[model samples]
Target chain A: MTAAFLRVAILPLVAGFASLALAADIPTAERRSGSEFMGPETRAMQDDDTTNPGMLWVLDGEAAWRRREGAADKSCADCHGYAQTSMNGVAARYPAFDAAKGRPVDLEERINMCRSEQQKATPLPFESQALLALTAYVGRQSRGQAIAVADDARTYPFIAAGREIFERRQGQLDLSCASCHDDNWGKKLAGAPVPQAHPTGYPTYRLEWQTLGSLQRRLRNCMIGMRAEPYAYGTAENVDLELYLMWRARGLAIETPAVRP
Target chain B: MVVLACSAAAAAPGEPALRSFAIVGDAIPDSLTGAPGDAARGRAIVFNRQVGLCLLCHSGPFPDEKFQGNLAPDLSGAGARSSIGQLRLRLVDASRLNPATIMPSYYRTEGLTRVAPAFVGKPILTAAQIEDVVAFLATLQE
Candidate 1:
């Protein structure tokens, strides 16, 4: 081949390599600063520090803890007994496998289970005020306790299922939950920082929603953003996703009904 | 008398109509026009189950749309509050208006995923649709 033609062909090839080198450097350019690793602004909003606005939910939950609600003339107080003593650290080890139900159960599910089995009351709806209050109250008992999701054989399958869902690619974006939350966490998308999808503080009052929602609800929202067909409410998939999130946040303190910006 | 004269001057011919198109930062001047919107069409852009689905973040004037979220601003008087240019900026590229707004730009014709091939170069709403919605908003002025 003529030198001129050879240079012409090689020029485009060199340009292609240059573009590849530029693309490779993009990630380094996007490397997050130290402050970026300290979680997003939403973390501050979810902090259960003494100044949290959602602290009111704890008070409401305490009230509901003592008030009678079921048809059989039973209140949570009748069975669980003074929450401060009986329920301490109970929230830290939940969504565990229940041999009776043959599935994992979170604090909400467990509360409703007790309501139906012992209290004879109708189970409160998910994200309902009553449910929030009760879960907040119960979770508050373990406010300082570190999360301790058991990885026993019985719970392992659900945890695996949850992790699978977290890593599975889905929707129009063809992105997995891990892509943005786990891998790209602390990185800025557009201008807002992405947060690690930890379930340390849940039943959180989100500024985006202007209301309280459970971890399942947040998962569904992420699914919608990914343009994936979200699992229906109360589905095993959602519960499993919640299980995985709780496990990921195993050592983080439980801050239920947390406020988030 | 001064207030009445000022109000009269504000209502003078060409002035009121010009006011309709006026821009004030990012907000509209009037908020009570009474122009009726085609809820059906608006619903397509605002709450279409498979399309615009704006309710995913913003609460709109329509009720009965469950899951009416609140991540973005309320769009009850968006027409009167924003000039066509401002609205165009918001619809074409909201990042230009507010870098942190989670509201997706409906008129962004590129870099969007999961869109049908026919819609690749077209905005979610047509120019006429934007005008119709703006007309409805102009009616909201008091």
Candidate 2:
């Protein structure tokens, strides 16, 4: 039996080596060549800009954070003081598994949770400009910190579910998330080079939209391309997808409201 | 109907040929449009790698692949959800459908200033390619 198992493993190893050899032989378009086609000036423009448009939302969020609202007469300042010092790196560990809720919660969800549980306020509507600004402000706290999602047993199922959703084929296009993002990244489609679907920076500013938007909104846009029915704004599918994205970008820095072409 | 007749009478047979065409301002059914597209041709546009490469921003039926764009929608069976006219608008120039769209016009005839000189007269996709793509989309019922 052991000998048979060894044989099976050996066969796969040989096949894997053959596949690697074939891959190496294939000619790949050089990175510089692709960049040149896009134009050196355009590329330089992208690198020159450091201030993310999302910063605009963050500024607004700062104001909202300080202003006293709700029936309880409390403000975000009441609990968290001087965000730069008190909330630094807080965004990096969000979308965390909340034991009380028995589910994963993103920064937006946490903000709303705090409003109701501690501030005695009504939760902000998802996708509302106010909520986006709040999220941007909170996310700014973890600008340089590496994302660190929990990988404990309790959270494993959620992560796995998220992964499944990412891989599942959907819509009229019969496409799975893995098809383009995982498979064809770095290649040009239409006129744009496909970037890895990393969530390091979110609530990003898009030149196409000329506005700041949340990661969920971005995902919704992708679904429309797939021609699949999108989940409601706060549905479990979206949350699960967020969980997967956060985990995928576990070590990348959070650049919320980043600029993209 | 009168406006259509007048426009058709006024249009020189070849003038419509050079003008950038896109289906706009009407909710025409797919059945009334031209015949369905050819999947083989549509696949070329979808997976050209250097051109159409729809896979860039979307995930689709093609599973034995890697790397796609993350910003756009997927296109597994787009035909079932949208009409041919809507598809035409998206293909001719998605900016018309959603001014925010990053997708470029495959049949642009005007506004060449925004594009490179080499691509000014050249469309991203030929009319035949668009027809084939639409035909293929019509087949994706499920």
Candidate 3:
């Protein structure tokens, strides 16, 4: 009996080892966005700029971009000059590998980096209205463009780490992100449908939250729901996870300021 | 939701004391409360969102509730599937059955990481509540 049990256990160990050579679980052809699962009202809200509440942040961000700030007295427009032409499709390719930081830096962190280094300004706090507004505005420029994370060796390790985090069970519930998003997407958990968790629409507005929130905020919320210790904002884990999601979401159109219920 | 103590003065109000119970194979043959639970109360608890949260991951034979979950096994015919003792053990801690289960241990409070400050040292459900849930589940023989 012990020999049979050992054989059964060792077979799974071998299979687990084999699976480390990770392939995308959801095929490129089959990947679906979170928007597909939403109600018609919410989808209509995302489709129109005027109806979407997240557009408010986008508008505020547009104003902040043109306004001069910091000791250097430079606005974002001073360096980038016209978001429609220069900033278009930029948000699709983040969190990118940062050579200076020796790690991945998300769009928010990149914005902060530019602020501190170029504008000589204080960094914005995570989830602050100003930061959300700025991220929404920038991300809005990438709307309709496919999410395209850099796929070179520089980002490979971080992406793997993110995948590990997604698969590893944690918290009192012993649930991983994959337990719901991968294993059981399209199923209902209570009344609500479980989304595919594509990082397509962000800084997306959630009706439950009644405000625009970043992808990191959403990630933290899931971790808390799992009863796990959410990493502090701006931590490497969050950025790495963002990178992995962006990579997983490659080919999906950006939908910044997308409305969700 | 009310917890009764033999010596009321020694226990904090509304605080549930965990009773020692033996696990016999895959079941807990003994009741945690030393008395049969009220099935009506158990059914009420199952339907209550704040208390049981069972509907979050289970669907059952209630025609009224619009949104039952599809995450776990349906509560319909659960009594026919599991023995009462088996149901009790599962409510206590399912990780012993399946380590990767998303179901929370409704009656366990230890070894959990990063529990919210307000819920520290408290099981998701009381001992009597577990029995109540078990009794309720045992009635779904169809």
Number of the top candidate by lDDT?
A: 3
TM-score of chain B of 1: 0.53
- Candidate-wise lDDT, in order: 0.62, 0.64, 0.83
What's candidate 1's i-RMS value?
12.6
The TM-score of candidate 3 is: 0.87
Please write out the lDDT profile of model 2 over residues A96-116, one tens digit for every residue.
Answer: 889999998888888899889
TM-score of chain B of 3: 0.87
Best of the two (1, 3) by DockQ: 3
Evaluate every candidate with DockQ and list the scores. Answer: 0.03, 0.06, 0.39
Candidate 3 residues lying further than 4 Å off, grouped into runs, are A1-24, B1-18, B110-113
Which numbered prediction scores highest in DockQ against the true structure? 3
Q: Write one digit per residue (lDDT tens) for candidate 1, span A1-261.
A: 322223234433532211222221114334332223444665565563565656777788888888887788788898879999999988888877889878898888899988998889999998898898888778878875788877666777787678668766655434467656655565444234566676766777777787767777888888877666778777889888888777766667666656665
Q: How do all models score by TM-score?
A: 0.56, 0.58, 0.87
Ranking by lDDT: 3, 2, 1
True contacts kept of 2: 0.08
Q: C-alpha displacement of A56 in model 2, angstroms? A: 1.2
Model 3 lDDT vs. the true structure?
0.83
lDDT of 3 by residue, A107-200 (tens): 9999999899999999999999999999999999999999998877788878878876777665656577887887778999887899889999
